[model samples]
Target: MAKAIGRGRGPTIIDVARVAGVSKMTVSRVINNEAGVRDGTRKAVLAAIRTLNYEPNIAARTLVTAGEARVGVVYSNPSAAFMSDFLIGVFEEAAAKGVRLTLVKGEDGLAPPEAELRRMAQGVDGVVLAPPLGELPAIRQVLSDAHLPTAVVAVGQPTGEGISVRIDDWQASHDMARHLLSLGHRRIGFIAGNPDQSSSALRLEGCRAAVDATPGAELIIAQGAFSYTSGLRAAEWLLDEACPPTAIFASNDDMAAAAVSVAHRRHLDVPRDLTVVGFDDTTVATTLWPPLTTIRQPVRQMAATALELLMGAIRNGAPAAGDHLLSHALVERQSTAPPNRARAPAPALS
Candidate 1:
């Protein structure tokens, strides 16, 4: 029988290392199921873990014993701010876990060629598909056929194809729209995300639902590719109308920043002449003048979680079933406020 600690705290990694008569690094390697320690040493660590009843942290609990596991991360997302944050999380977690990562970038909004995917499959134990790429069924099929465990990030919902880590896009957008409505903005223009991704539709649906539920509220929709340039066009389209919206809600920070630019170009004072809000509170959200009111999507955390899931699946010989929905928050910044009904439109930039 294992001896229990007198203190309330449970046995830790250090305790496991001590009981096994090995270094903490050894214990970590054993916990991660990495190749290195001799059979005897591995057995000793396992025995200590069992005897002490030590529960590894969530990241350490996934046992990938075949070898030093290699994970491939595939991304084709257009948002630089979002990708920068997400890659930081993934790299940090992978480094801590002592796993190798291979990055594959899709070209022209398409998944990596079949030959490239096959090569990637041979080199890596599992894969993490970042958004836009995650939405591609062909990519999923290729990975599936390769028998590689997979985890997808930023998908709107689980497709029963692999482990999914994302937030509830519909609910998040709905809440943002509700925030605008509460602030007394009834005519709101919504700039949508890339149509190729599942989140775009769900976000639009969320905004529409909120507008439909409220009396005297109207929603005007414009398409965007989740790019700053696309946002520019969308914002221009909405603002050029005979009856322009008092407020604009963009599906992401890039679009929201563009809306702010447009507002500035027309010499309209934000919140006094127009109120702009956005989702995915990325780096651009705060960097902009009059920082945007937006949804904090936890992009970095989601990427980390997805990688963890991919590791777990690689370890267990099967992907974990179901979706993991992380929480999102509406961060109120300087951009949103009650509409000023009496304001007049200023002259457009020459």
Candidate 2:
């Protein structure tokens, strides 16, 4: 049995173990999110820790461990806004665990090739991959061959052989599309992310599902590269169609912001003349004149969770292969409204 601690004395791992009816090592494993511990045992330890308000002495533990855990995070997406938010979360968690995080961007503006990724995995204990990087079969094969622990974040579907952290992109996008349909916008234009990314197909599917269920709703899709510039061009093309949509849904906040710019160039009033909604409620979502209506993907939390998964995999000497699903939200702002009474004239599609 563990005795109650006096003031100024923090709850220790032994206290948690006693309360959880497990050994001290079990408590430690739970705190570090290490594998090998049974799920039921892990939960009991966690519950005990929560009850005791326990905080692990991570720095001291790192010293005892001798070697620092090295994690490589690979990304090649063009959304600076998304990356910034993600880094903040990853950095916070990495610092807490005394783990080192290295960012590697591909030279070709895509996920690093298998050879390049193999080089990155040489020294690192584990890797965190984002988007197309996570979706690459070659990257998965090379990392698997290298015997490195891995976590995939923000992917449509995790390769099913490693830790995957993501929100429900399909349901989130579907909800956003329903929001537009509820607002009386029947014709919606969609600007897609890079087709190579799994999110592109998943999000598009969600939007199509919503539109299909609504009467008198029509969807027009424009291919995009998931860049602000791509959003601008895609929005231009959409607005120039034979019958332009009254609402535009861009797959990301960066593209949505670009859509706002295009609307302004055409001298159209947002929400009143054209409504725009975006996925990923990143900083760009709020920075726009009319704050964008979007689906909040919990970018920071997802990254933080991915880092945790990676660290645990490193400590346990096993790749954690499981889907970690987080929550998402629908954020309504000034950028959306019911369709205007009089529709604007359309130009050429190209």
Residue range 1-350, candidate 1, lDDT tens digits: 34456597888765675566544445667787776467777888899998988889864444333236678899877788988888988999898777899999886457888788878865666788888888788888777655566788889867887789999999999999999999998999999998878899999999999999999999999999898899999999898877889999999999999999999989898878999999998999999889999999999999999888776654443334568999999999999889887874454555
Give the Cα error of residue 322 in candidate 1, in Å.
Answer: 2.0
Off by over 4 Å in 1: 1-67, 344-350
How do the residues 207-294 of candidate 2 rate in per-residue lDDT, one tens digit apiece?
9999999888999999888899999999999998878999999999989999898898888889899998898999998887999999
Q: Give the TM-score of candidate 1.
A: 0.80
Give the root-mean-square deviation of each candidate in angstroms. Answer: 11.6, 11.1
True-structure RMSD for candidate 2? 11.1
Q: Which residues of candidate 2, in runs, are more than 4 Å off?
A: 1-64, 107-109, 113-115, 345-350
Output the number of the lDDT-best candidate.
1
Per-prediction TM-score:
0.80, 0.80
The stretch of ten residues in a row with the least summed lDDT in candidate 2 is 59-68
